[model samples]
Target: MRPLASLFKGWFLIRRDLSSSRRLFLTAVSFVLPLALWCLVSYVDWIWHPDIKLQLSSEREGNSTVFTAGDHISPGYYQEMVVATRAENTRLLASTPPPKSSKRANQKLLRQLAPVAISHDWLPYTEAQNDASIYHLWRDIATGTKIPTDPALTPENLDIVKQNWAQLAPLAADFSLASLPETPLLKLIPQGLPANPVYLPAPHEVWRSGWRDFKAVPPEGELSMTQRYQHSLRVILLGFFWACVVGVPIGILCGVFDFFSKLFEPFVDFFRYMPAPTFSTLLVAVLLAGDAPKIALVFIGTVFQMILVVSKTTRLLDPSLLEAAQTLGASPKQMLTRVVIPGILPNLYNDLRILLGWAWTWLVIAELIGVKSGLTEFIETQGRFRNFDRVFPVIILIGVTGFVTDQILSWLHGIIFPWTGRGNPIAQTFFRILFWPFRQISKLSDRAGTPT
Candidate 1:
């Protein structure tokens, strides 16, 4: 009981550091909470699913728009489709002499079964547009040779398949576009499972779409996912690198002496507030279109703020280090180099890490400012089409790229500055292994140099 109480007390201690287990638990909970809420809103039936995602759909006469599988519509709209389609179907069957339709039209009608067949694992998605395979699938499903489950065919949809197959089979045993029936075939009803609004797709949908998109081969003359990712990384890293190159020395000078500070910090402070993005049109006008303007925007956006933040971090260094250096007869150059720079390096690294993240916020805007390249362009195009499932992956990829890079930098920080007591265990272990021979040789030399 006492041990348990101590463990619990460690958890609730006010203004104190949490135990490592609690730290990991809270970190995990940070992600889990949002996902759990999303799952509740998505998977829990009768909660907030305001739309039905059509697993099967059809084309009506004289309408060029075709709603196929995976389309979303409001419940009211779905019901309207059902009523109108049923009415149109009745008119077709009751018409005297059973109104003839084009073989192409009936051929397309038979293909609506593709979604149902795919859902039941009776067909592969890549084979979807294969009319010959779709023809055979219709026969298999109608005769019950293929059983549908998970989303087993509703009795109504099953009946439509049987009836449509009856008309289709009479024309040809297998798929022959020319051999397709001239008679009208029954349209599959607009059937769907319950779904949330398209903007908030299910987690499975996001994962599946992400996988498919990443694995797919892009069209020729277009960029692949890797290429887009490389372009985005190039923009961010180049921007941050240029900012550091131009800003770090100025910031360090300002921190070390009042002369530089009075000359530079005042102007930097004033200019940072003017907004980096406001320069986009001017940049495009001067720099012209391409990666030049995009990279320049990131540099302009991040550099001013980087200078200010790094200057502040420099000033926060312990004055006692300066006092100690002065007492040792260190000159002004030695004081700046030996005392100030080394002392501020750790904090400056952290400051730059944060500023790197700040630079990423401008990525979408930066890409748009020029020729519209990188992941942002892809996101905008998909967003316009309202394919939210496809959109989530690109957004998630950007987030993940930043997160993993930060974590790697963080782990390396600890390894690179072990005296600061902030290195990763894995990094420390690797460092020890890699330097073992040198460390052993140094020990042997030290022992030989000592007098007995």
Candidate 2:
């Protein structure tokens, strides 16, 4: 109790800095707690799993929706699928078997058991679609040699495997396309575990899906993930660059001069109230599609706010420094350039860091307008198709990109303004390494000059 109390002491002091270790610990917990909550709802049974996640699935004759392993369905819909598939099998047995299916089609149907066999380590994943290995796996399950326990088959499915094998074994002991029976085999019953809805995929499922997507080859003419990442970076940086160029000097002038303030502030304040998106269609019409319109939207969204923020920051600089500079006989331009800009720079840097995040907030909306482009384009496409697992990676990537970029900028801020004494320990160490060669050269020069 004493150790724990000591560990957390001073944690609640207003505006006080926590120790480096404590800050890092809190940062880790911030990320971990959300993941833990996600896991709690995802992996725990009897805990609000409102749908069924299929492990074994089959096609219905008339239905175009072909469910595969990992597909999510409502419990009520799952029941309907079972009833429908079972009725089809009953009809298949009662009526004459339909015309012999192509060997290719039969091989694909046999691969339905591949998920089951792979889970129990009976089938190698690389050979999941291989016919001969899956045929032996079915025989082993039917003859009671290999038992599937982790994801054991439904009792009804076990019966179907035995029935299907009875039909297959007589034609050929091993898998052979030519030796396959003309009559179709019994399809396995659809079975699943209770799960959360499709939108909330399990962590491992997200990881696997994300990994597969990142490594996947895009179809010809589609942008790869790296290209998408670069494009997003380009959009934000370009937008922010133009905003800085046009807005910052005007903002500084507004802060310094009453004439500029009265002339611009009223109109700027009025225009800022109008949401930037309202002008998106107008921008598209004038800019006429492609990247130009998209970049224009981001500029319109960020520039007004940036001007207001920078002007406010500029006005907040201490007045005593300007008084001292005037007493020292500084000229008007000298005071403006040398006093005001330098005094406000640190806070101004902090303000821009925050404003860059605002620029990112506009990225998704900006990308969706005119021509869809960047990572947001991929997210929009995947989300529209209800592939939330694919969408999750892109969303997470954007968040991580923004967060990491801010952290790096913050670290550089501390190193740049060492007198401010504000930066993480890692940044401080990196600052030291950056000047290490110069320090070493100075030490050598001092030694050579000393009497020896």
Candidate 3:
């Protein structure tokens, strides 16, 4: 009778310690308000800002020629610099006074190639110069027109040639240098140069075509707001799915045994300190050799933070829970299935919620890694070109997406594991308005269920 009485009291105490309702509600609402505000702001902006248009809409259908040569300008400028240098070398070789041996010939050839004075209008020249200097080949690639090589091109010269070859290889179909009819410099040039594609803001130009509301228009194609929303959601879902696939089993192992924890502890700690973008680079070098840098960035950043949350939460599970299960004649598998997992499930869900929030931060870093798509990519691309208006909307989109994701995770946690939440006093103040309605419902339910 005494032992039975003690068991009941112990169960009651544990239940008391574990029982949490208001705390969970408060925690949930605390995370939800910011997301709501963000969504509201985004929707309002979409309603009011009707001037902006997605880049893809400006193109005439089937007019692929409109794709600017400026897209290839970075490498093109480098090639021009190399060509200019080679020309200088040819000029030096043809001069009346010739130099001695092949090696001396090369050295003399190089000496004869002096730096050309560039005009202020030569932006391409400047860009190439900057690129070559950083790569330690400005003198070789940019000044090489002054020399001739009987023995062969120097390694420095070879490197420049290699870089130029690599750059041209992908666009071999598009390379051309055609003669044009002479005319006035300004008027002789085609107004819409395919290569330059400089912006010409004519007052009569259509502000937006087809779509009156810029926000509703897809950035490209037959894109709509619904499509953009779907794409964004898919990215988040894919990211979260992979995170769980990588994080859960390891988390279970860490919780179930002490040895596994020790083995992975240092690795987890080291990775936690490392920035999420590092994982993107490391993964790119290993698994997906062909992965676009942007994809690698997303995968690395998502998994890195997810792994930390899962392992840390598992590491913190109560040791006593396992001991008690063992005392009850539970088999190891049974202990894990019934006691260990349920004990850690709440913390796991909470970690997942926090991890989703971290995913947004990683999203920007991922998009910056050579991706030409997504809100983060758009924001970065615009920001680099100093298009503040375009950049701002993309930033707002990212924030709204992050906020919505956070809210969803919170709502899921509330519905799935109501018993898991314990209160932090800090959440109470922030969630007062959010909590009041729920509190009233709880009171009404209690009164309805009570007997007269």
Best by TM-score: 1
lDDT for residue 200 in candidate 2, whole number 0-100: 80
Model 3: CA > 4 A from native: 1-229, 279-295, 421-452
lDDT of 3 by residue, 258-296 (tens): 787778756876776777676665655564442255444
lDDT of 2 by residue, 175-211 (tens): 8889877677778889888998746877876675577
| Regions more than 4 Å wrong, model 1 | 1-11, 60-71, 102-152, 170-180, 424-426, 435-452
lDDT accuracy of residue 17 in candidate 1: 90
State in Å the error of residue 266, model 3.
1.1
User: Residue 91, candidate 3: how far off, in angstroms?
Assistant: 50
Query: Any residue pairs clashing in model 1, and if so which?
Result: 414-422, 414-423
lDDT of 1 at 241: 89
Looking at model 2, report the run of 10 residues with the lowest lDDT sum. Answer: 118-127
Candidate 3 or 1, higher lDDT: 1
| CA lDDT, candidate 2, residue 114 | 91
Q: Poorest 10 consecutive residues of model 3 by lDDT?
A: 184-193
